[model samples]
Target: MIRRRAFLATCGALGAALLSRRAIAATAEVLASLRSARQRIRTLQARFEQERTLGLLATRVVSRGELTVVLPGQLRWELLPPDSITWWITPAGLAYASSRSRASADRSAAGPMAGVLDDVLVVLGGDPTRLEPRYALEAALQPDETVRVVATPKDSRISAVMRSIEILIDRDLISPRRIRMEESSSDRIEIRFSDVRINQPVDPARMRPPTEPRP
Candidate 1:
């Protein structure tokens, strides 16, 4: 617990330093730092909104959204636009909501699934190592600095719902800058953060479960 919290906070605090400065730190050192980084990341609640082009549909769709999260666990994502959807992950399990869509009870597992919260946190907490086996990390160290990690699904569900997930880590702060969620033939979902608050006080209500439907 101590180790993880420290990791999370450092990642949030040293967002800039981790970018271009390649430390003489060993791989273990680097990995250790990332692990702690993920733990201390206390909270991240922000607005993620953007306009996207769908090549398959041959049209542009605009969407606005926000997500709020608390340390080591707990999060919520709401997308409002071409389609309205909200997904919440709590200690209890996964909850998906749309106009009338809810995750089947059988599919709502307690822990974060590979493509769910674990993936979300890896990006937010700045650890490419955890997902490295699946994604190839490409980084830059020059006039323009950026670290881009791309993941190609090795399984059917991952491949069916997603072609690949691309993460953009801003070189200056070592924090996530953007996340590209792509699908084959071009329908995509991209999340760009703004008003991002890390390790700050957040509304507790945001972390609570959503209202359930009537039986």
Candidate 2:
């Protein structure tokens, strides 16, 4: 009877150890995945073809851009070909869009994107530490075996411009596949990445403008 009791006790101890190992493994996976994701984001540049679909028709607003991102909160959205515009996010609010004439009218506007700011900052900046207060975050399954994150803004006006923002990260690499911005009126801005480079040399002049046109 004592032997049986001791055997059962051993079994219980074994089960507990197995469970503890699984929990530790899960933690390690989470940490490894997050680290891989941050590293992938460190060197990312893509050429994007933006299409703005207004209610009835799909209009091709073609813009080929190179994005250079530096760490937790620096990004440059440069539009080349068909037109020229740059959306800069220096964590403050730095952006310049071609005005009416491309040469004579670059006006200042209001909102998060107007200056050195971007919605991605909400997540890439401090969301890791304080996710709840800044965004309503959720995850969904994707066909490509990726887990996608949908972020709804806590900021008022920006939320109006965007219903929700989605970031699709690879199952393995954990790097972003696409950044999709859904507008309130069912319009969407989808930026998919290809030919991505990480942690490469970036010229400061790439973020600099040739001329500032004041309207």
Candidate 3:
């Protein structure tokens, strides 16, 4: 009886190992498909609705915005009026303008914030290859046919400020349907995209930083 019990236990362990391997293989296939789809995109534009929850205040703030991305490295994100703000990111640097003030910073001067911006761009760009180097990615196909990918920052500096980023990809469009950034247990931001136009011509003016008001 003792020998039989040990044999059964060993079989159970082997079965579990096989299941783990299969899960890993499935995740790899999903990542490969995502990478291939993202490579074909040159430019993209989308309208987004962002919800930000503050842990300390227990308040939820909602904002509407638009985003434009021109690859190899240019992105413009703007929030509509009342709390109007615009941010432009490119290889050159990061620039932003708000109703109250405007500022620009070079990549080196941006410090840790630069890393955060770069990661955002990578995730939005849907390039797993670039993200794999800095983040640990796990992906699964949802029952609704969407691919959900969770990326955890591997860099200590980034992880200090961000816990993880969750993205839901639309299988047909090969674009993100939603992105959630978890800063902590209670502090998180979720953005949902709509009116997404992929591989479209983005206006050059859209990529430029907002200009300062003339006196």
Q: Each prediction's Cα lDDT score?
A: 0.63, 0.58, 0.86
Which segments of model 3 are wrong by more than 4 Å? Answer: 1-15, 211-215
**TM-score top scorer:** 3
Over 87-163, each residue of candidate 1 has an lDDT whose tens digit, in order, gives: 77665567777787566232344322535455666666645567656554443333455555556666665567667
**Clash-forming residue pairs, model 2:** 43-197, 43-198, 43-199, 93-115, 93-116, 93-117, 94-115, 94-116
Lowest-scoring 10 consecutive residues by lDDT in candidate 3?
A: 206-215
TM-score of 2: 0.64
lDDT of 2 by residue, 6-96 (tens): 9999999999999877755653454445545565454455566555555446554545677677666666777775666776565334555
lDDT of 3: 0.86
Q: Which stretches of candidate 1 lie over 4 Å from their true place?
A: 1-39, 80-85, 97-117, 172-174, 211-215
**How do the residues 1-215 of candidate 3 rate in per-residue lDDT, one tens digit apiece?**
99999999999999999998888788788888888888888998899999999999989999999989888789898999876999999777899989899998888998877878778877887577578888888888999999988889899888878889988989763778999999988999999999989999887777877652222
lDDT score, candidate 2, position 128: 31
Candidates ranked, most accurate by TM-score first: 3, 1, 2
Summing lDDT over every window of 10 consecutive residues in candidate 1, give the lowest-scoring window. Answer: 104-113
Better of 2 and 3 by lDDT: 3
